[model samples]
Target: MADEITASDQIDEITDQQFLRAVTSFEAIIVSQIQVKNKLGDRLNNAIRAGIIILGIIAVSLLILLLTLSSQIGRISNVVGAMNQDFSTVSVQMSEIDTAMISMELRMKLLEGIAGQTQVMDQEVVAITADLETMRGTMAGIKSSVKGVRGNISNIAVSIDHMNVNVQQMGYDMQRMGRSARSLNKIFPFPLEY
Candidate 1:
């Protein structure tokens, strides 16, 4: 009976020590789990911050691109407007050229009439040679015809002067147009040979 009681007391002591060891192991496991959770949370926070920074960088880049494009468009519009004014000037010059051409045509017709009159005077001089009795009257007619021809020549000189002035103005306008075109070529996507 004494040996059985001592065995029973030893068994109770072993059970109490086993229960203490199990409780300590459970607490250690809980502490380790909390540490892992804290590390994971820190990693998630870092990833979120990195993503936000990248998004901000992208947004700023897009804004700069947009502003540059807008400025370029505005400059193009101004250039186009200036070209329109140049074209308008060219149109007016063309009209002036047309007027000059019409005046030249009228002068050419007058010259043709003068040539006919000179042919008539030649015939009259031949008649004067053949008939010496009408020489005085023939001389008077020739003198008046010469004076008319001199007046016609003076008018022709004035008309030619006007035509020259108009032509020079047209040339000036063409040069201005070329300058505008050169400026406009800078904006083209491809290189211009001219």
Candidate 2:
């Protein structure tokens, strides 16, 4: 009976030891599984955070590009507007130049007409000068004729004075001859020598 009782006690002690070891192993497994799950969760969280940061950077870059493009578009619009204004100004200046050319052409035509009139006037003046020279020559000839007529009149007056003096002498001689003839006839009236 003592041997049997000793064998039972030893068996009971062995069983309790085995149960404790099993429980310890199960607890160790549960702890290891929990640690592995925590590690995996940490890695997943890091990857998700990295992906979000990359997406944010890309969005910021896109926003910056949009801003730069808008600025460039504004500068291009200003250049186009300036070009349009310059073209309008050039068109107006061209019209003014055209008007000035037209006015100059009109003035040239007027000058041409005046030049023609001046030519005709010059020819008329030349003709009048010739006519005046001819009149001067005619007047000179008339002056010479008048001088010759005055000389002839002076000679005629001198000849008429000489003729008047001869007439007076002839009248005196005729009276004396008549008186002598009468006296001779009376003195010789009684003496007739036969």
Candidate 3:
């Protein structure tokens, strides 16, 4: 009976040792699994935080770009508006220029009419100049005749009224020539007698 009791006690002790070893190994496995899960959770949290920071930076950059673009758009709109205003002013000025051109056309017609008459005026001036030369020759002949008449003062006064009439005609012609010369105030565009 004592031998059987000792063998049973030894068997019980061995079985209890095996059970404790198995339980300790299972506890160790459970602890390692919990550590792995914690590491995975930390990694996921870090990745989420990094993603949020990148998203924030991107959002800020987009906001800045939008602001800058809006500013540029506003400036472009102002420039376009200014150009439109300038074009309107230019259009008004163009209308005024058109009116000026019309006035110039009328002036050009008047100048053309005057230019046509200038030739007729030139021939009249030549005729008048020829008459002056004839009168000068007649005056020279009269001077020679007067010089030859020594002490014939009675013949020099051949009716003062007749001489006055001839002198008045010459004076009228000279006045007409003077008026024409004043109107044509050019410096020597054609052959002119001194």
Candidate 4:
């Protein structure tokens, strides 16, 4: 009976030790898992921070590009305005030329009336007629030149309109880019807090 009791006690002590070892092993595994979780969290934080930095750089670059494009568009608009003013000045000059041509026509008619009144100046009359024909040819050439200038101005106006449309489209694209940047900012909040 005493031997049996000692053997049972020994077996009980061995089982107790085994249970304690299993508990210790489980604690070690839990600690290891906790360390792994911390490492993964740190890696995730670093990745998020890097992504935010990259997005910030992209946003800044887009802003700079938009500003540059806006400045260039302003310069182009100023140039177009100057061209319009120049066109107006040229139109005024063309009007003055037209008035001068009318005045010259009136003077020629007066000269013709005087030459017809004196039949003794037939040679002078022929010379005056030749001068009038030359003036007519010159006026025709001036008219053709004016027409060509008007056509060129029309083409320039069309081109300006096209440029304006392109600028408007670029502005819309810039707005969309701004919205996208804002959305990105919202998705990735700043990790640092005040």
Candidate 5:
């Protein structure tokens, strides 16, 4: 009985020591699991922060690009308006040019009519010059005939002066004869006056 009791007491002491060791091992395991969970949580937080920073940079770049595109579109609209105004000015100038061309065409037609009249006038002038040449030849013959007539008139004037001298001599002879006849009548005593 005493051997059995000593054996029973040793068994009880061995069971108490094993229970303390098991409790210590369980506490160590729980502490290690908590540390691992904390480390994972820290890593997750760092990743989230880095992702937020990258997303912010991308958003800022997109906003800048949008603003630049809007400004370019506004400038393009202004240029288009100016181009429309220039096109309107060009159209007005073209209309004026068309009117001028029409006026020039009418003037050209008038010039053509004047040119035809000038050609006819030139032909008439040439015909008149030919007629004048013929008249000049006839006038030359008339001038020669007038020169001969002038010489005949001079000869007739000289003959008229010679006849006047002879007439005066005859008148003197007649007067002498009339005096002789009167003396004879006085001697005869005939009445010649009756």
Candidate 6:
């Protein structure tokens, strides 16, 4: 009877110590779960902060790119203005060329008119030369006719002087014969003289 009572008391003490160990183990498990949850929350917060910083950097870069694009657009506008000025200058030069061409065409027409006048003058000169040659031929014929008339008049004058000399000698002979006949009538009688 004494040994059975001692065995029952040792079994009760063992049950009480096992109960305390089980309670301490349950509290330790709950603490470890809380620490794990807190660590996970801190990591999530850090990740969110990193994401926000990256987004800010991207937005600022996009703003800078937009500003650069605007600057380039301003430069392009200036270049376009310069090109417009060049085009206007070219148009003015083309207009000047057109005016010069018109002037040249007018000058060419004037030259053509002058050439026509020159041709008419050349024809007039040729006609004048032909008329002068005809006048010279007429003058030469008149000179030849005058010379022939002078030669004919000189020959007629020579023939008339020769006939005048023969008439004078015959008149002298007739005078001598009339004187002889008078002398013979005086020698004959008074009747012959009467």
Against the true structure, whose TM-score is highest? 4
Query: Which residue pairs in candidate 4 collide?
Result: none
Model 5 C-alpha lDDT per residue in residues 12-124, reported as the tens digit of each score: 98999899999999999999999999987886576557557656755665565556556555655555555555456555545555554565565556666668687765665
lDDT of 2 by residue, 1-194 (tens): 99999999999999999999999999999999999999978865865675576567556655655665565556556555655554555555456555545655665566666686877656655655555565455445445544544554454455445445544644564565456545545644655355
What are the clashing pairs of model 5?
none
Q: Per-prediction count of colliding residue pairs? A: 0, 0, 0, 0, 0, 0
Instruction: Please list the residue runs of candidate 4 whose C-alpha ends up more than 4 Å from where it truly belongs after superposition.
Output: 116-194
Residue 89 displacement (Å), model 5: 1.8
For residues 89-184, write the lDDT of model 6, one tens digit per residue.
555545655554565566556666667687765665565565556545544544554454455445445444543444454455445544544554
lDDT per residue (tens digit) for residues 1-194 in model 1:
99999999999999989999999999999999999999978865865675576557556655654565565556555555555554565555456555545655665566666676877656655544444434344445455545555554555555556556655755675565556445445533466354
Evaluate model 3: give its TM-score: 0.55
Write one digit per residue (lDDT tens) for candidate 3, span 1-194: 99999999999999999999999999999999999999979865865675576567556655655665565556556555655554565555455555545655655566566776877656655655655565565556545544434223333333244445555755675565555445444422455455
TM-scores vs. true structure, each candidate: 0.53, 0.52, 0.55, 0.59, 0.50, 0.51
lDDT of 5: 0.60
Candidate 2: give the clashing pairs.
Answer: none
Error of 4 at 5 (Å): 3.8
**Model 6 root mean square deviation, Cα atoms:** 71.5
Error of 4 at 22 (Å): 0.9
Assess candidate 2 and give its lDDT: 0.61
lDDT of 1: 0.61
Better of 2 and 6 by lDDT: 2
lDDT (0 to 1) per candidate: 0.61, 0.61, 0.60, 0.69, 0.60, 0.59
- If ranked by TM-score, best first, what sequence of candidates would result? 4, 3, 1, 2, 6, 5
> 3 or 4: which has the higher TM-score?
4
Superior by TM-score: candidate 3 or candidate 5: 3
